[model samples]
Target: MTTLIRYRDDAPQQALESSTDGAVIIERLAALGVGFERWSTSRSPLPAAASADAILAAYAAEIARLREQGGYTTADVVRLTPDHPEREALRGKFIEEHTHSEDEVRFFVEGGGAFYLHIGDSVYQLLCERGDLLRVPANARHWFDMGPRPRFTAIRLFTDPAGWVGHFTGDGLSARFPRYGEPYAGA
Candidate 1:
């Protein structure tokens, strides 16, 4: 299920609005100029089903398709775990605001996280669970925060591998959004 939660920048303890409804999530995100969707279980991609060469081939094909459909140039796929030491490091590294030349595409396959997009003065914070995806456009400043122990994996589709590169934004706009942790449904 996909989730969306809104909170004042300083009040992460309680969400002003939270929902697991896909329609609501999409509508809210769309309002901020962010694109989001849910994929059917039938369309799930399994890397293990193919040989190494075949996997690469499939990945290439998928990349091309996404590029054509979403105007993206490159992509990154990652499997995240709460135990990953780099998780904290990556979080620390991204504390500053930033933007990409192309949209930021991410599909959660295992775990969930909050992607906060700072569009104009409003902040759109999306909680992306498994099977949920989000595409934030070029020059959209934002930041992401995952749980303390993410049992999650995600596929990140991008428009430009290089253009997707981050340009550090000196502003503290990121401080306007929430920091994420904990389960959305049970905890």
Candidate 2:
């Protein structure tokens, strides 16, 4: 399931709005120039791949469709488990508000994560679980939190094959926002 929670950046403890409905999620994100969609895979659990090339090859058709639709040039899988030693570093890297030159797109294959987008006067906290696909437009102000116990498998589509490069905004607003942790409604 996917959840969208809206809040005033300064009042993160209280949600202005929240929903588990997919249509509503898409509509709300779309209004912010972001894209949200649900996708299905032929298999229940995607095949395990040790390398980016293997992962890309495992989902070639899906990658091709995304590439055609978004002009993405690269596709890769990122799997992080709770025991990963670098989880803290990776989480810290994205905890600060930042923007990318190209759109940041991710498809969650398993587990989940959250993307907090700061647009205008509100902060949109999007909790994405399995089967969820989210695309944050180029230059969108946002930060991602994989939580303290990181566990997720995501397929990322990049406009540049070189992959993720973020420009920090130097604003420490992320700490004011709620971190990812609560289980999706009904899990």
Candidate 3:
């Protein structure tokens, strides 16, 4: 299920708002200049272990639309499994707060992850599941958590030829909030 929990940056112990409803999620994220939508996953027969080429082909239409709409030039698929040798290292790289020079767009084909966006005075914890397409605006302060046993296949779109790159915030605010799969207990 896809979920969105909005909390005050200084008050991580309590959620200002939370919902699993797609419409609500979309509206909430859109208000923050972040795009969120559910794409139909049945466009092609995509297995959990689908290849990048296969995954790209499965959503070519949607990809084209996003490319036109967002001026995105390239798209790729990234899959990380529990058995991946560098899962821990990769997860660690993204769990810290960071920002990209270009928009960070992703379509979740399988499994899930969480994107913590620190915008203004609020931190929106967006849990993206299968079929969820989330577009975090360029230069948005955020970080991602793929969990300890990451098992997700995501299609990523990039406007830059160099693709995904993060600029760490060095604020260490991410550590103050609940991580992926952790129970949200407010202080």
Candidate 4:
């Protein structure tokens, strides 16, 4: 199930709000200018381990619609398993707070991942499972955690042809928050 947890940026020890309801999550994120939705994953015949081209082809219609809506020019698939050779390094890179030149959008095709968005005085931690689509607006201060033993496949949409290029914020705020596999449910 998808989960959304909101915490005060200055006090990550407690959650101000947490919900697993889709409508509530959508409303909360939408109010903050973030786009959230649940897409139907039934049409894709491709498996989670399918090649990027195959995955992209399976979701061409949805991708095309998103491209038309967000002016996105390219789309791709990123898959990572626990045995990935650079799992630690990749996880480390993603756990650092950063911003992109264009909006960061992703649709989880398999497994799940967490995104922590630092906006104003709140930190919204969103767990995106299969069929969940999240779009963090451009320049949003955030970091992603795919868990210590990562396993997921996601479709990413990009407006910039250059693709994902993170501009590190060097805030070290992420270090204070619980990571993907940690005990954050109580918060």
Task: Tell me the whole-model lDDT of each prediction, alpha carbons only.
Answer: 0.66, 0.85, 0.89, 0.89
- Local distance difference test, candidate 3: 0.89
lDDT of 1 by residue, 24-100 (tens): 88888888788788865443455533343442343465557667998765555677666787877766665567888
Per-residue alpha-carbon lDDT of model 2 for 1-187, expressed as tens digits? 5789888877777788889999989898898899888877555475554466765666677779889999998777889999899999998998899999999999887889999999998888898898898999999999999999899888899988575699999989898777898532211
Q: What is the lDDT of residue 47 in candidate 4?
A: 66
Clashing pairs in 4: none
Q: How many angstroms is residue 179 displaced in model 4 relative to the true structure, after the best TM-score fit?
A: 0.8
Model 1 Cα RMSD, 1 decimal: 4.0
TM-score of candidate 3 to 2 decimals: 0.95
TM-score of each: 0.75, 0.90, 0.95, 0.94
Candidate 3 wrongly placed segments (more than 4 Å): none
Cα RMSD for predicted model 4: 1.5
Highest-scoring model, TM-score: 3
List runs of model 4 lying over 4 Å from the truth.
185-187
TM-score of 4: 0.94
lDDT for model 2, on a 0 to 1 scale? 0.85
lDDT of 3 by residue, 1-187 (tens): 7889888999888888888989998988898999998998776447555778988988999999999999999999898888999999999998899999899999988889999999999999998889999999999999999999998889999988685689998989898888888878542
